[model samples]
Target: MNNNVYDCAIIGGGVGGLTLAIQLAGAGRTVILFEKEQYPFHKVCGEYVSMESYDFLERVGMPLSAMDIPIINEVKISSVNGNSFTRKLDLGGFGISRYTLDSTLADIAKNKGVTLLQETKVTGILFEKNLFLISAAQDIYQAKIAIGAYGKRSVVDKIINQRRVKHVSSEKNYVAIKYHVKVELPPNRIELHNFDNGYCGISKVDGGNYCLCYLTKSKNLRDNNNDIKKMEQNVLMKNPFLKKYFTEAVFLYEQPLTISQITFNKRSAVEDHILMLGDSAGSIVPLCGNGMSMAMHASLKAFQLIEQYLDENISRQNLEVLYHNKWNSLFSKRIKTNEYIQYLFGRKLLTNTVIAILKRVPFVTDILINNTHGSKF
Candidate 1:
């Protein structure tokens, strides 16, 4: 048990949590961060980050400009029947693996005086008398504020499940899988291939590796007897582009990293007096290729609000309501737009038609992309 209460305690050491911790600690505020796993682990992410977060990441200690990461400026889309189109991205993005990005950010968080605890799983968070009590393993820690930055889904969600806004449409069960592979792909371009019930994205990341990731309904896996390889061959490989990648790319991992039961349901930005950041608050569909950037952007929003609350500039109630509004203002429209996109791409005929339209009027692709992505923060 720790008797000292920190200024803020962040659950989950993801990009958002790590970035927020860095921000708070850099300003001489006490922060304690918890991560269930040790640093440098892989996550089921697209590995693409939009330009909106480029400057913000640098501000929080990521030297992306000097990192020599791949700058992606073009996009190629292929439908289930192999119909395809290529378009220029209005606001391009960069690629770096979660394995690399999170670890680097974690190192920065530690250096900035954040008490980062690795392999510590927070079992529960309770607000009592205006302070947060965080329980992890056999230890209890205290903080003035608690933040939930634990990605898409977690057991911690059960605590706030009662207060969550139910977005029924976003409740569909989805599975996401990722692999680092050696493939012949253009470094400055990203390719998205849509198949029945799902889509896969591939782009060059750091270390000359390409990240090949996909998200699909869980039923797709069950239809193939819950065998990943069978699902790839029977469902995903139906698309010509995906077939080529499957047959040609040298998969670096023996087994792909995967996450299941992913949902895009609208979650309250503030629940039980604990501020929710990043995917915990709400996640955009993976097909949009902007989730990583959105998560980081939310962190900046949260840091500013948290800073004000810590300085006694705002009441706790005000902080909660303001964060909820700011988060929705920043990302609600984008999430809704991406949800519609995910719907279109998940259907075979609709996907093929959209690709045909995009092929003829390439600017439409730019408009759609701009809608899903945001300006630099």
Candidate 2:
């Protein structure tokens, strides 16, 4: 192993890690990023970023127009019974596929002088005397500080045996399926269609395609013989709107991508010398449509706190306190609100009632949209 050390080591090359690498490299820090996957890979994501991330993207010198993705200014919510409501979102969001999004940021990081080790996974991190020894498969890297953007369900999370609060209920364990489909969905609109056991979203993406994604209770799929196509045909087809799309939409990709058994209860933000960001930190409910934007925003927070600690201006305890406080202030309430929304959607009666009420109260819809998506950064 070489005895060289970097100023910062980022463990995941997703949106959060790549964004921080670009930011820190621009600030003249010697940083290294380890990603287990190659560029232009698809992540099981909603593929929508809120307006709140516009300023951050601009700061990173990523031109919005250059993305070639569709812009959505309105949102439509529908129920299993075909009842629907439309609302004009106060702030717009963008749709770019993860393949393009990740590659673009990776290119920006490369151009900004951040060392990126693609197809490399960080096995473990050893903390000692204000430095970290990060272990990959056959290589080791030393760094003064580490950021764990390694994402959800990483082996590192298990290795740390991270503490889990008691409130992590079984109801939160779910699965997500996504597909790139060529359809006639409006470029400036996004649809959230709710079925019996869960909901699915559809919107236009960068490559003139539509991202059709859904998060459903795993038990529902299991009860249907573990067949995705059968589950869609029998359960999802019950919803007329989704039935129409599933029957009519031409899938652009060969098959739908799926991530199973996602747990969204909660986890520690900082543990064992690693700071989590994005989904690594905590994931918001998908219906809010702010997951990617939240990930990007969290990168800025993680960068600030890590940079301060690395500069030796703040004690580790104080740094953790500040980071936790900032994270809670920015996202805790929003997450809780989304969780409540998810619960409401789980019940068909409540979902329809809430949509009917919100349709009548335009101001309430505005507030809901604002809370779901914060003001632009």
Q: lDDT per model, in order? A: 0.90, 0.84
Evaluated at residue 367, the lDDT of candidate 1 is: 80
Q: Candidate 2, 262: how far from true, in Å?
A: 0.4
Off by over 4 Å in 1: 161-171
Task: Summarize candidate 2's per-residue lDDT along 31-142 as a digit string, tens digits.
Answer: 9999999997998888888978987897897877666778899998887777888888778898988898889899999999999999998887888888888899798899
Q: On residues 37-81, what C-alpha lDDT tens digit does candidate 1 reach at each position?
A: 999899999999998898889988899988979999999899999
Estimated TM-score per prediction?
0.97, 0.95
**lDDT score, candidate 2, position 270:** 77
Candidate 1 local accuracy as lDDT?
A: 0.90
Candidate 1 clash pair list:
none
- Candidate 1 residue 308 Cα shift, in angstroms, is 1.3
